[model samples]
Target: MFRKLIYIVISALLLFSCGGNGDGGKTKLVFKVGKVAGQSGYLAQIVEEFENENPGVDVVLEILPSITDQQHQFYITSLEGGSSDFDVFALDVIWVPEFALAGWLESLEGKFTDEQLANFLPGPLKADTYNGELYAVPWYVDGGVLYYREDLLQKYNVKPPDTFAGLKQAARKIMKGEDNSKLAGFIWQGKQYEGLVCSALEFIEGNCAGILDDGGNPVINSERAIEALAFMKQLIDDGIAPEYVTTTDEEATRHSFGNGNVIFMRNWPYAYNIFNTEGSKVKDKVAVKTMPHFEGCESASTLGGWQLGINKFSKHKDWAWKFIEFMSRYETQKKMALNVGLKPSRKDVYSDEDLVKQQPFMAELLNTLLQAVPRPVSPYYPQISLVLQAKFSEVLSGSSSAEQALNEAQTRLTEIINRRK
Candidate 1:
């Protein structure tokens, strides 16, 4: 069931490579794209077209429902084992350190021409590189966005808040004056997933807490962080945000917001097209803008997206790189962004005539993405995020105080990193 419902389902093929290169060394490239079930359609078609464009290369794209961090753990197990069958990989931005540390990815500095590197956005360029080596190329980008019910806010004579305190006050006012019991004030991804890391990072960066002293060990339990988490908790316990938000991921939160049950939603750009569509109850009433900010910090969003990396064990390094390059092209990115509203990783796509016409939020989306902060880089980031997710989930659910949760998370993360180091 997990195989069928998740992204593109390609069962891990067991292979014992006791042999040498075959057929006069004609490489067979197998591209494994992170699949998200039905969301694999666009990339699948693009892969077919890419294959048609390059005849000699035999390319197979595996769509994995890799949006979840659990899926990342699943693949890391295989890749670390030197699985040659899976050539190209779709990876999360946070995974660069883990993948690069294991030496599972090919260094693309000498691989791709300077002209090609010049075409990518600086955010992805920096994200794909680890230490001093360039590894994966970002395929698509998604940054946090602030979505609100335009009509509802206007009906209450409220304008979109520009700062964190302003937003909380606005949410409180909206909740009390309106039928707030039936409407959540603000909705965020608070569950124990990679998304929680994204949301928490936004809070962290927006609060001026990027003070990692080395080894990327963040001062997560600092006063600013504690205050941010408290504000988040107050939003829930004080009735501005719903209590159920502790368990809600992007889908649940989006579903609630799309039904007009929430006045403000902090989510990725994907929700822009989804929540504003005709089928959604929020149609014509929903609008999006940049995420709000704190006192000193301007509006900051967690900058992250997915990257496509070639496995060092792949039999088709040459062809796989070619396929990676094919997908990384501006044209292909624009098509994917327009097709499913997956924001493009390229800086150039934001101004595309077609894209601008279809998605008017592109301007602010571009700004947010440029300003999006990548999570702290470390080989054990997954472990670090795990500790935070568990504790933050508890904090959101009111099972623990924000200070208690951050302290616990910080302690656990420190232990995990120390043991690894």
Candidate 2:
């Protein structure tokens, strides 16, 4: 309650401060927009363009924290308190269901025609909808992919693996041939966080299983899930992946791979440009492919990215939506893609001539993006993920067997879902 009250006060002040005059001393309608910080500043540039195009509406961009958990908690506090300090904001893909269910996001059902929505990648579009209502619009997208040292693979005469078993075999061969005691076979985001849940989902679904079935009941303790978890455990125990992976996240794995210490890595699309940058050790030697799958299962990359939505409490719903519409435009998304290497949520942007020429990898990723899978879609997902993280950490850290950890997770998830009912 105290936190909520404090957020309310902060929001009220923000509202008053942002609702001020334009730079030219002309009165204009101001709409505040909040999004995670550390972007390429293309957003600020786009905001300037929007102001020039709209004339009479000023948009203020509030840069939020980069940490996902901190951003989630900040939104919960402000939205739960009915604060309209920001008229529009960005939401992580997984937050759409929870935010919409809480009545925090405005319904955009009829705002976009079916054809416009169709232009976006199916995975992100599905994630932005809740209970058949469009609650947000995809701005940019991300999906996990496998990064490997292409030169090393060629030198070792190893084909990029399409299945987990093949990946293990190829990794072992490369490790043996390289003869670098400092090098590890593979690395991934295994720390106990949302990234861990995404990594675990890829492994589980690669084995043709899921955390929840079609009816939304927990199915995380199935034989396939146990097999997947056991495979991950074996990666650590057998020294195929280092024990330190259990403590690392996306950036850590990227750095380890960029430093030329790992044979393979599972990470999102954003790391591609960074790896090719001048100072990176693996520059020009890296290539990406769809994440490896189990023997009979198809490859799966976890669907991730941010969406733009209007605050239900905003006084400027129409204007907030205009800003969203602008941001989702092909030109805006293209600029973002070319400038920062952010994967475009719009399918057409991937085929843009300049984008294909500059970032050909993105064009190649279209097929993989189409097959990407989302984590369970539920308002209770945050709580469910928390349970999975703890249990998964236990399994990965060797404190519990895969079966024991998953069974405990299943029990805890059941309790969480049932209590919500």
RMSD to the hidden true structure, all candidates:
6.4, 6.0
Off by over 4 Å in 1: 1-27, 113-118, 211-215
For model 2, state the Cα shift of residue 375 in Å. 0.9
Instruction: Report the lDDT of model 1 for residue 8.
Output: 39
**Candidate with best lDDT:** 2
Model 1 per-residue lDDT tens digits across residues 76-188: 78886878878888888888878888888887777777776777777777777888789998888877889988897898788998888888888888777885567888889
The estimated TM-scores of all candidates read: 0.89, 0.93
- Against the true structure, whose TM-score is highest? 2
Candidate 1 colliding pairs: 7-35, 7-36, 7-37, 8-63, 35-63, 35-64, 303-372, 303-373
Local accuracy of candidate 2 as per-residue lDDT tens digits, 4-90: 999999999898887663266532333433443346376778789998998867777787767888888888999999997888888
